[model samples]
Target chain A: MNILYTKNISKSYGDFWALKDINIEVPKQSIFGLLGPNGAGKTTLIRIITQIIFADTGKVHFDGREINEEDVRKMGYLPEERGLYKKMKVGEHLIYLARLKGLSRNDALTKIKYWLNKFQITDWTDKKIEDLSKGMQQKIQFIATIIHDPSLIILDEPFSGFDPINVNIIKDEILKLKNKGATIIFSTHRMESVEELCDHIALINKSNVILYGSKQDIKQNHRSNTYTVDYIGEFRNTNGQFQITDQSETEEGYIRSNIRITNDQSPNELLSILIDEVEVHAFQEKIPTMNDIFISKVNEGTNA
Target chain B: MHNIFLIIQREYITRVRKKSFLIMSIVGPLLIASLWVVPIWLSTRETDQKTIEILDDSGFFKDEFIETSSLKFEYIQTDLVEAKTEVLSSENYGLLYIPRINLDEPEGITFFSGKNPSIEVIQDLEWAMKSVVEDIKLERSSIDQATLDSLKADIDIDMINMTESGEKAGSAGVATIIGYISALMIYFFIFVYGIQILRGVIEEKSSRIVEVIVSSVKPFHLMMGKILGVGAVGLTQYIIWLVLSIMITTGISSYFNIDRKDSLPVQTEQSGVIEEEQENEFVAEMFNSLESIDFSLLAFAFLLYFIGAYLLYGSLFAAIGSAVDNDADAQQFQLPVTIPLIFSLIVLTAILREPDGNLAFWLSMIPLFSPVIMMMRIPFGVPYWEIGLSLTLLIAGFVFTTWIASRIYRIGILMHGSKVNYRILGKWLFMKN
Candidate 1:
């Protein structure tokens, strides 16, 4: 089921459209990547979903119902412009934010202790946010965002200030949250992470959604019908049926060529033809990475 | 409602626990107590007697200077040069030379002191010289000295306020002091605590925590929570100061018996019995002057105006805070908010001068200035209808400002990095989103 979706949502600042005719669906128990370049209204769409801002011309639904104030209690948002009260104690700040999301004092305290231990930050509970390093503060901010056990979590650039190890830790946590049936909307400029994590994604550019779908489907739709073949042969080209984009001979006397076939050819047909000509060691279709798709689609948008 | 309360709790607890708040609460009363007690104590303290060397080159002025407990006159038969040398060599506190001159003119008298003489010494010297010169003039004109001496009585004016009902003694001096002080205190708290609301909002915005909190609670709630929280803190500090100052003032005042000698002037060469009688009457008048004010009504009006004025200004301050990116940016908006506060303060002197004048009446009726201007006018017996109207307007002002502020607040807190001019803020106020 679609846990959250925006129907024709649009937002504008004076004459500048921050988000325009944006529609997205976040499936339940899925890690949905919200991919966009800078100034692409990714943050604006996330804000609208979290209700930090109201969409100028559409409706946002949570669990197939129109979003309301109570939906905020069930939703969590970690904004890209992160902040905590620098003068406030780490534990107090967390508990306060937790209680604000409708947890009782005791519940907030108990949850705070659990998260502190999970982050290995129990010792830093009494320290102020200013005293913590940037990575540690980001961890605390993450805990603050999700401390109330929100079912729908939205993180905007959550990995910005984290170290590689801490990034893995947070990625593990995001996966763990998905396993526990939480719907997550992850927004970032890091396309490689999106390729590894997102089951679905929507690419937005210039306040408009240029591409969106399940990860596999989007890659397939943008596929160029190209394949790389690794074979040992005294090579001869196929005459006008397939196009060799690149050819290189390995040091072990093996020839590797990237070939794109015409519309009439299939991978199996090329594989059978290659087998008859040379001993084919390996052959695979080259699926485009999210990084390539994001760049190409964004460039396509800017050009158009 | 609950979220607003929680926010208030957070704001209040953090501020009240600050070391600066504790220090100010304790040190403020001590400062106020010292301000009132020190001058009274200094006047009553005993000082070493100082003798003045007087050379009467005008022989007619011999034995003219009187000896008081703190100052002594020692007549010397010496030339002016010798007297000056003696004074320089510490023979006396200073030298007073009455040079040879016609009593009618008396132009050549000189007082030489190493440092600036105290005001008391100067006044005494002038008094003695004037009395002596006048007596001599009267004697030369063939008037009886005894009659002139008896006619040297001081004139006292007992001012009365004549109402339609009867004549009642006026307490202008005491009323002015009370009125001016209360007006200034209201102005001070509103300015101080109003900025606190501004700074608190700026802190939340600059730190970027506003979005996090805004997600949980409406921005209106957050603004109201902060404004009320800071106002409560201000009220707490004010009450503590009030109670402490009163305790310290009364404690020190009675211990020093400051009321007695400070109120009565020293009567020169009067009979002991008559001086004692006049001192008692003066102390009685002081008590009567204090009792003339309606303390309960003054306190009630003071608190009502204090809260009204603070809430009104506090909301505007919060709006300015949300509109700006930082404290420096707040300066552009601050001037407009503070103009009314400062204007009321500038008009305070005029209110004290004429509490019943049309300027005071109209200014006191204005909601922005009423908190202070009306406070000053209250001590001078303002009409009840004016006070009621002023309060009604103040309440309406607070409500209207809160509405306007919250409208801006709802949008401004989430906005980042935009240069916010007054026009932008005006648009935000009316913006539906």
Candidate 2:
């Protein structure tokens, strides 16, 4: 079931349209990646979803109902430009955010303590935000994002400041949240994290969603019918029968090359040709990476 | 509603707990108390005596100059050159030189001192010389000095304001002082606390915490909460200052033994009974003047204008703060809002000059100037209808500015980076939610 959805949403600033008729849905208990290049209206769409800003014309539905003020209590948003009251202590800041998300004071305090301890940042509770390192502040920001345990969480560039170790920690936490049935919508230029964590994705360019679907389905749709084959010996000169896109001699004295099947040939048929001449070490169909697909689609969008 | 309260609570708590707030609250009262108390104490202390030496080359007015405990005059037989040398080198406060001159037209009467003498001293010397020369001229005409002196009776007018009910004693001097003070206090509070609201808004916006908080509450509510929260802080400071000032003033007055009766500089009369009776009458008249001023009404008007003007200006200040990303950007927007306030301050002197004139009447009715000019006119006895009209307009002005400011604030705080000029601000005002 979709937990949050926007229909025909558009936003404009003076003469510039920041977002235009953007329709997107975030399913329950799934990590939804919102992808866009700089100034592609990704932040604007997220702001609309989180109600930090209003959609010039559209409808936002939360849990199958029109979004209302109370719906905000069940949504947590961490904007791309991370900000905290630099003078405020970590513990105090977290508690205040939690309370603003509609948690009672006692509940906020308890949850803050739990999150601080969970992140192993309890010792830094009294330290001001400015005094913490960027990575440390990122951890605190992550904890603040979900401190109130909202059913839907929106994070923009959530991992921008973390080191690799902290990144892994946050990734694990996100997976844990997914396990606990929390829906997440995050935007980032880091495709690796999206590939690792996101189950669904949308690629927006120039105020329009050019591509969107489940992660597997979107990747599947972009894949070309090409395969890489590693073999011990070279194939016979059957250039007309089969096509080798590119070939290279490996250091292990094996011939490795990418091949595209012609004449509606199946993988088995292509394999049959290779099997007769040499020992087939490895063979696999190539699926496009998110980074390649993102670049190609954005370029296609710009060209069109 | 709950989110607004939460925002207010956060704003109030964070600000009240700040070290700056505490320091200002404690130190502001002491500063104000000293401003009132120190001057009075210093002026009341006994001052040293001064001796004036007169070198009369004319020698016609030898015994004319009199002596007082504070100012003593001595007639010395010396040439102008010797006296000039002595006066410049010696510690004498001043030297009075009377050169040989005609009594018909007195000129070249120079009083030399190391520094400029006080206006009071100059006026006293002028009065004594004029009277002595006048008596000599009258004697030349065979007119008796006694008759001339009797004819020089000083006229003292006791102004009484007549109303339909009865004639009440009135004093313009006291009323003008009170009016000036009341108007100035309103100006001070609005300027100080209005900028406080601006800074608070700018702090929230620049820090980027405004987005997180506004996500839970309406932007208008957040703006109102912040403006009201800072106003509360200002009110808190004012209350503490008022109480501390009262305490300090009373304490200092008693410590200095400033008895009203003893402090009254009542000039002695020829008859002791008349002097005592006159003193009692003056005391009663001062009390009666104070009683007839309607202090409760003035205090009520003062508070009403102070809060009304503060809210009006504070909302605009908050809007200006929201429109800009930093102080540098805010400067461009701040001028338009502050111009009216500054204009009101500039015109205050004009209002004081003609408290009952057409300019004062109209300016007092204008919502922006009403808070200041109206208060200025209040002590000088303004009509009730004018006060009511000014108040109504002031409240209406606050509501109008707040409505417009919140609209601008709702859009401005969310906007980051871009030159926010007047055109953009106007566009933002009309932008849909």
Candidate 3:
């Protein structure tokens, strides 16, 4: 079941189209990655869903109905250019945000206490936001994003200012939130995190969605029928059974080579040919990494 | 609506809790109270009486010189040289040497002193000598003092304003003062409170908190909340000032056993008992004129115009704040918004000069100028329909400016590091959200 989706979303700023004919669905209780390069209209699309800005022509459906101000309350948004009132205390700022998102004062206080204790920063609650360091502020912002217990949480560049340890903590929290049944839209240029956590992703390029689907399905579709083989010595007589796509030497004197199977040849046949030619150590299919797929797709867009 | 309230609460609480706000609240009443009490207090304190020694060679002015509280005249029998030495040696202020001359054309009446004598002293001495010569001349023409005194007429014209409710006693001086003061208060409040709105908007935009705010609530709500919040701060300060000022003034006045009705002439009596009678008459006339004014209507109009003008200008200031990244960038936009306000101030004297004139009518009809100009006319007894029409236009103007400002504000807050100009602001006004 889809928790939120956009249909035929298009937006323009004068002559420049920021988004065009965009469509995506965020499934229930799953991590969704919204990947795009700088100025590729990702923020614009996020704003539309948050109702900060209007789309020239589009409809955003949350749960079973069209998105409204009420629905916006059920969704939490942490913008990329996020900030808190410097003069306000951490507890006050969080409570203000939670109340703005439709939580009662008591509920906001309880949730804030719970989150602060969970993050082990309960002592920092009374301190001003300006007094906190950047990493601390990032954690506070992260807590603010979900303090209202929103069903759909959108975090833009959520890990930008966090250290590795905090990033792992946040990643764990995100996974835990998902496990407890919340749909997450994680928008960022970082592909490694998308690979690690995102169950689904939509890659936008130049105001268009260039690639989108389940992570497994996309990785499957981009596969070029290639496999890597690690061997001790190079016996290059394949008898045209496969084509050598790339070859390199490992630091441990292992010949690491990649080969694409020829017409209708399965992995078993390729492995049989490789064993006969050299002392085979390891063999594996070469599935493309998200980073590689992103670069290539973006490059193709630029070239086109 | 709830989000707007939260925004307002935050804005108001943050500002009211500030050190500056506390300082201003305490200082504002003292300043206003001093403005009222200081002049009266100073006037009541006795000034040093300067004694002038007169060496009248004509011998016709010996009895004419009279002593007043601030100026005393002493007739000396010595010659001019001796008088000068005696005046310099003594603690007298100056020596007045009156040379005997023909009564038809008096000339060269020199007064010697250590420094330049005040014009009041010189005029006082001259009037004394001239009156003596005039009495002598009248005697020479066979006219008695009683006849001359009876022939002199002192005419006082009581201005009676003819209105639909019959003739009403009015004083132009009192109206001018009231009109000018109310107009100035309106002008002062708009600038002080309007800039607060601007700075608030700039702070949010520069700190990048506006996006997080807009995501939860509408930009319109945020702008209005800020404007109303700052306005509430202004109103609170004004009320505290009013209460404190009244308390201080009453406390001081009662402690000194001073009655407001008798205070002015009593202070003037110490300077010159001769002017005391005239001062009392003028004070009484001013009090009568105050009675003729409808304070309730004036206050209602003031409240209406104050809020209308503030809302009108406050939104514009907010828009300017949103459009710029900092106070430095706001100068260009601020100029146009402030021009009308400054223009009203420049023409305030002219408006008061002829409160019901064509210039006043047209300027007060324009919403930008009406808050100040109409206020100036209100104390002078404006026609009810004219006031109503101006107020309606002002309300309409506020609505229109707020609409334009919100349009620009919603877009401007999100646009950072872009050099904004009037043309770009114009574009943003029409840009879709």
Candidate 4:
């Protein structure tokens, strides 16, 4: 079931259309990767869903009903340009933000303490935000985002200012939250994280979603009907089953050749032809990475 | 509503705990108290007496100078040069030279001193010589001094204002002073608290915390919270100053045994019993006029106008702050917003000249100028309906400005790194969130 979704949402700023007829659905308890280049209307769409902004002509649904101000309490958003009050203490800042999301004071305080201890930053509670390191502040901001135990959490470029260790820590926390039945919408340009963490992705470019689906399905659909084979013997020819697109000699005296099926032939048929002529050491099909798909789709959009 | 309350709490607590606020709160009352205390202290304190030597060439001015506690006159038998040298050599204040001249044309009289003599001393010597000359002229014209004295009359008019209740004594002078002071206070508070709202908004926007905040609460809530919070801070400071000033003034006055009647500079020996009696009467009349003012009504109107004016301007200032990236960029927008306030202050004297004139009436009805102009007119006794109309218009204007400001603020806070102008701000007001 979908936790949140937008249907034909469009927003414009005077003569500029920041978003246009955008449609996206985030399934329950899934890590949905909102992948896009910079200024691809990703932030605008997130703002619309958070109800910080309104779409000109469309509907945003939270659960089964149209979203309202009260429904926003169930959703937590960490904007790309997120910040905390520099003069405010960590504990106080968290409590304030939690309370703003409709948590009672006691509940806010209790949740703040739990989150701070869980993140192992309980000692930094009294420290002002400006005194903390960037990564530590990012951790505090992360705690503020999820302190209310929101059902749907949206994090935009959450790993921008963190070290690798902190990045992994946040990643683990994100996965833990999803395992706890919270849907996550993660927006980033980092393709590698999308590959490792996201279950579903919707790639938007130039105010439009160009590609979207489950990670496995998107990779499956972008396959080029090509395969790479490693052989130790001299590579001769295929028996009219496939065509060798490229060939290279490995440093260890092995031949690596890229082959594409020519006549609707299966991989088994190509392998039988290759086994007759060459010693087949290893064979694998080539699948596109999210990075490759993102670049190509954005290029296609600009060209169109 | 709860979110707005939270925002206001944060804004108020953070600012009130600031070091600058504490310093201003403590220092502001001392400054105001000194304004009341210093003048009376200076006037009652003793001054060093000065002696002047008189060289009379005409020989008609001998024994004409009279001595007072602060000044002493001595007659010297010497030439003008010799008298000046003696006066300079001794510890005397100056030398008064009455050159040989006709009594009808007294033009060559001069006072030579090492430094400039105080105006009071010069006026005293001139009066002494002129009185003697006038006595001689009166005798030569065959007129008696008693008859001349009877011809001189001092006129004092008592103003009586007829109200619904009855006739009450009024003083235009006292009303003008009270009106002017209250208007100035309103002007001062609006600027001070208005800028505070602007800076608060700028801080939230520049720090980029507004996005996280607006995602949870509406931008209108945040803006209203900030404006109200800062205004409460201003009110807190004002009340503290008022209490502190009254306490200090009364404490110092009682300790020094200073009475308003005694604080008046009464030079009995120099001015004689007639002028002293008149001075006493003037002070008594002023106290009576003070009692005629309706302080409760004035206080109520002051609070209403002050808050109404502040909210109106405070919202505009917040809008300006949201449009700009920093204080430097706020200058272009601030000028237009503050122009009406400055204009009212500039025309304050004109309004006071005729409180019921057409200029004052029209300006008092306009929401922007009414806070000041209407305040200045209130002490002079404005019709109740006129004040009601002005107040209604002011509230409507406040509501209108707040609506405009909130619209601009919601969009402006999210936009960054763009050069904003009035045209862009107008576009933002109509743009969808």
Candidate 5:
């Protein structure tokens, strides 16, 4: 089931279109990647969905009803511009934010404590936010954002300040939220994280979606007409029937060569010939990763 | 509504818990009370009103003034040389020599104290010298002492201001004095606390904590909370000062009754009958002044004005807070908000002179100035319609300002680094979003 939807949503300031005709759907219990470079309408969409800024021309529907004020109570938004009351203690600040999200005071307190302990920052409860380092503060902010147990979580660049270990911790928490049937919109430029976490993604460029789909589908759609073969019987560095873009011989006397089909011969025909000539070990098609797809899509967009 | 309450609670607790607020709340009233009470006490306790002798060169007036415990007068022969010599050598505090005056000419007086004569002594000697001149003229006209005494004594005018209500007589000066003070206190607390809310918002915005808090609650709630919370604190301080002032003023008045003759003024005087006519005029002056104060009305009016004025300006200050992004920008908004408050105070003070006049009536009806002007007018007897109308306007003004401020707060808060001026803010008000 679709948990969140944006249909032809666009926001503009005078002449600059912050988000232009953006359309996307967040499925339930999925960690969806919202991929964009800086200034690519990601934050704009986030603000609109969070109801902080109204869309210039579009509609947002959460759980099949038109977005209204009370919908924010069920949504958690962690903005790119992070802020906390520097004079206030970490635990108190989290609880306050939680209560603002419509949790009872007691419920907020319990959740804040649980999150703080789960994040292993239990000792930081009494410490002022200003006294904490940037990473620690980021952790506190992260805990505050999720402590309400919001169903629809929109995080914009949530991993900007985290180290590798903490990044994995947050990644696990995000996936855990997804496992708990919460739909998540994780926006960032880190393609490696998209590969690891996102089940589906929408790559936006210049206020337009250049490519979007399930991670597997998007990558598979970009595969080139190339194939690689590994055989034990016979294969030369340079081939006559095919163009060997590159080749190498293994220590076990098996030859691995990357072959680009010059003619419109099918993979099966090439495989039969390979089977006839040499003892076939492995023959597989190469598929593009999300990083390659993202770059190529951005460049393709610029060119188009 | 609960969110607003929470916001208000946060505002009150955070601010009231501060050491600065706690210290100022206690110290402000203490300082004001000390100012009101200490000087009066010090003046009464001094016991050193220096006595000076006058040597009038006007041959028509040659009597020494008088002599008593702290004062002495010596009549010198109409010799400037002898008087100057005596003044330079005598133990008397000063020699006030009034130059001979043709009844038509202004008198040129000289003070020959060892040092400069105090202003009070010089002024007292001037009043006394006038009497001697009048006596000489009476003697010249062959009027006997009995007729002269009767003529010179002020005929008490029995003022009867009656219109089917009981007749009451009051000194115009005392009424005006009370009216002026009532108006001024109402003005002071409103502007003081209103600006406090503005300054506090600027401080929070400058530190960027507003963004954090904004995420949790609406900016309108935060602005209203701060204004109401600060106003409550300010009123608390005001009540403390009022109590302290009443205690000290009443305590000292009872402790040192100047009329009891034990106050030392009577002891310092040469005689009870400074002259028979002088005694009668002084008694009439005291009774004439005491009838003007309507303490009950004064207290009642002050409460209404205090609450109304604080809410009126506080709501405006809250708007000013939301209109600006930072303190530097708040200066522009500050002038517009504070100008009305200060102008109201200025107008209120002026109306004290004629609280029942046309200017006071119109100003009292105005929402911005009414809280203060009405307070001043109350001492001079305002009608029920006037108080009701003025207070109603003040309440309405607060509600209107609160709505406007909330709208500004909603838009301005999310915008950062963008300078919002009058033009932008004005447009923001009309924009539907």
Candidate 6:
């Protein structure tokens, strides 16, 4: 079932249209990644759902009800720019933010202590926010966002200012939330991260979705009829059903050449000719990487 | 709501815990105390001896004066021309040339000093000349010594205010001075610390922390909580100062039994000088009488006005804070809110000298000005209608400002990098979607 859905969502500020007619649906228990470059209306769409900002002409629904205060209580949001009151004690500020997210004081305190201990920041509880490192502040913000046990989490650039280890740590946490039946929508420019974590993604370019699918399916769909074959034979038949796209000589009197299969020919048929002509070493289909796909699709969208 | 409490708690704790607040709390009362204490100390404290050689040309009196508390007067019988040279040659202050008293022209006493005489020297000369004039007058009138002595006694001017309603009659004394000092202390501090709250909100808004917090709480709750929390911190600091100042004042007063019985009165009528009609207007009398206020009424009105005015102005300040993206943007809005506060203060002290005046009624009825003016007026007697009307306006004004502030708060806090002005704020308020 679709948990969050928006159809033809549009917002404007004076003459500038912030978000054009856009449609998206985050399905239940799915890690939905909203991927876009900066200023691609990703934040505007997130804000529309979060209700911090309103859409001039649109409708949004969470769990079949119109977006409202009650829906906000069930969702968690971690904004890109992290902030904590610098003068406040770390523990106090964490508990305060948690309670503001709709937890009772007792519940907030219990969760805050658990998170602090879990993050190994228990000794730093009395330290002021200004004294904490950026990663530590990010950790505190992450704890506060999830303390209320939200069912749907929206994180914007959650891994921006973190070391590799901390990034992985946050990635694990996001996965854990998704494991427990939480629908996650994370926006980021890190395409590699989308491949590693996102179960489903919708690529938005210039306020329009350019591509939408699972990571594997998207990579598969973007794959050209290209294959690499390693054979101990002379590089001949440059003009044939299978034409050499790249050729590089290998050791042991072999040629490593990449070929593009003709539309009518199967990979097996092309391989049989190479098998009859020479001793085959290796044959592999060249699938496109998400990086190549992202670059190519963004360029294609621009051209269109 | 729970959200407002959270906001208030955050603001109160943060502001009160600041080192600046603590330092100011300890230092402010001491600064105020010095205003009164330093003057008295300077006047009564004894100084080193100074002998003055006054070369009086005209035959005024016999030569040598007795030593009184390290001061002695000496006279010489030199002619005006020789006295000027001798007085300049000697280390004396100057030569006073008093021509014969014609009784038709004001005598111009020439003080021929190379340098200007200090205020002490000027005062000494005036006193000595007064004694000479009195002696001459007594001798010419054939008055007895006892009558001359009685006539030379110092007389004070006392102003008494009488109400037509026969409610009470009074004059300024130590209590009145103390009350005015206390009321002014409250006024200045409230003005200072209340702006601190506005500044604090502006800082948070500019720094953009307000974005993360307001997402979960209503803007109204946040604004209300912040204003209340900061106000509470100010009150805490003030209460501590109040307690410490009273203790110190009481301790010092009892320690030395510092009774200022010789304090300059409301008016000192110089016996020989004529009075001007314009100067005798009863307005100064009314104000001087008000300086000594009824302790109960004065204290009550002060507390009420301080709190009511603070809330009224503070709410608007919070609104201004949320309506602008930065301090630069906030400036466009500050003058409108602050002008009424300043005007009320001026009108209260300057224009509305009489509580029964029509200007006072108009100023006291406006909610923004009422808090400040009513406090000043209540020290004088205010009619029940004036107080009731002012309080009603103050409360109503607070409600209206809160509503308007909320509108701006909700709209402006989320916008970034945009210059918010009357045009946009006006448009935002009218926006329904």
lDDT of 6 by residue, A31-61 (tens): 9989877777888788788887788987998
Candidate 6 residue lDDT tens string, B1-433: 8788878888887777789988988887676566556655554453345556665534554442334443555666667787777877876656666666553343766767778867766665667566666677677789978887787655556645565544443554433344345446545655676677667777777666676776687767888888888888878888888787777665655554555432222222232122222234344454555544666767776777777777877877877777766667677788888887667655644533466688877877888777666666665567666777788787888888777877777777666777777888888776543
Q: Summarize candidate 4's per-residue lDDT along B1-433 as a digit string, tens digits.
A: 9989998888889889899988998899889988888887886664457899888889888877766656788888877787887787899999988889898998788899988999988888887787889988997898988888887787889988777877788899999999999999999999998999888888899988898888899999999999999988898899889898899999999988987775667654445466568778879888877767778889999999999999999999999999998999999999999999999999999998999999999999898999999889988888889989999999999999999999999988888999998889989988877
lDDT of 2 by residue, A1-304 (tens): 8998899999998789899999988899999999999999998888788777889898999999999878888887877776778888998888877877788999999998898888877899899899988888878878888988889988888898888888888989988988998999989999998999999999999999999999999988987777898888778746676677889988678888888776777889888878888899999997789998999999998898
Estimate how well candidate 6 is docked, as a DockQ score. Answer: 0.41
Lowest lDDT block of 10, candidate 6 chain B: B263-272
The residue ranges of model 3 lying beyond 4 angstroms of the native Cα positions read A229-263, A267-283, B51-58, B73-123, B133-144, B254-274
Specify the poorest-scoring 10-residue window by lDDT in model 1 chain B: B263-272
| Tens-digit per-residue lDDT, A135-214, candidate 1 | 99999989998898899999998999999999999999999998998989999989889989999999899999889899
DockQ of each: 0.68, 0.58, 0.78, 0.80, 0.32, 0.41
Which regions of candidate 2 deviate over 4 angstroms?
A12-16, A229-257, A271-282, B50-69, B72-146, B162-166, B260-288
| lDDT, residue A81, model 3 | 93
Report the lDDT tens digits of candidate 3 across residue range B1-433: 9988998899889999999998998888888878877776765573578888888787777667777766787877876777788888888999887788778988778888888889877887777677788889998999998999899898989988777877778988888888888899899999999999999899999888888888789999999999999998898888888898899988887776666644563432223564767776777888888977779999999999999999999999999999999999999999999999999999988987788899999998999999999888888899999999999999999999999999999999999999998889889988999
Worst 10 residues of 5 chain A by lDDT: A234-243
Query: How high is the lDDT of residue A126 in model 3?
Result: 94
Best candidate (score: DockQ): 4
Measured with C-alpha atoms, the lDDT of residue A227 in candidate 5 is 83
- What are the candidates' interface root-mean-square deviations? 1.1, 1.7, 0.8, 0.8, 2.5, 1.8
Mark the regions of model 5 whose C-alpha exceeds 4 Å error after superposition: A8-21, A37-40, A55-58, A119-123, A162-165, A204-210, A224-304, B48-119, B122-130, B133-137, B153-178, B203-216, B244-313, B349-362
Which ten residues in a row are the worst by lDDT in model 2 chain A? A234-243
DockQ category of candidate 4: medium
How much DockQ does model 3 earn?
0.78
lDDT of 5 by residue, B1-433 (tens): 6667766666666667778876876677667767756665665666554556667667555543665333456666657767777776867787767776777465576778778766656665666666766776777789888888687654656554442356666565566667777777777787778778887776666555565556556677778777777877777667777786677666766776544233222222324465444555545654655554556767876787787777777877766776676677788778877776678776765676667789888887777778777766775677777888877887887777777777776766666677777888776676544
Query: Mind giving the per-residue lDDT tens digits that candidate 5 earns over A136-170?
Result: 98888788778888899888788989999999999
TM-score of chain A of 6: 0.90
TM-score of each: 0.89, 0.86, 0.91, 0.91, 0.77, 0.79
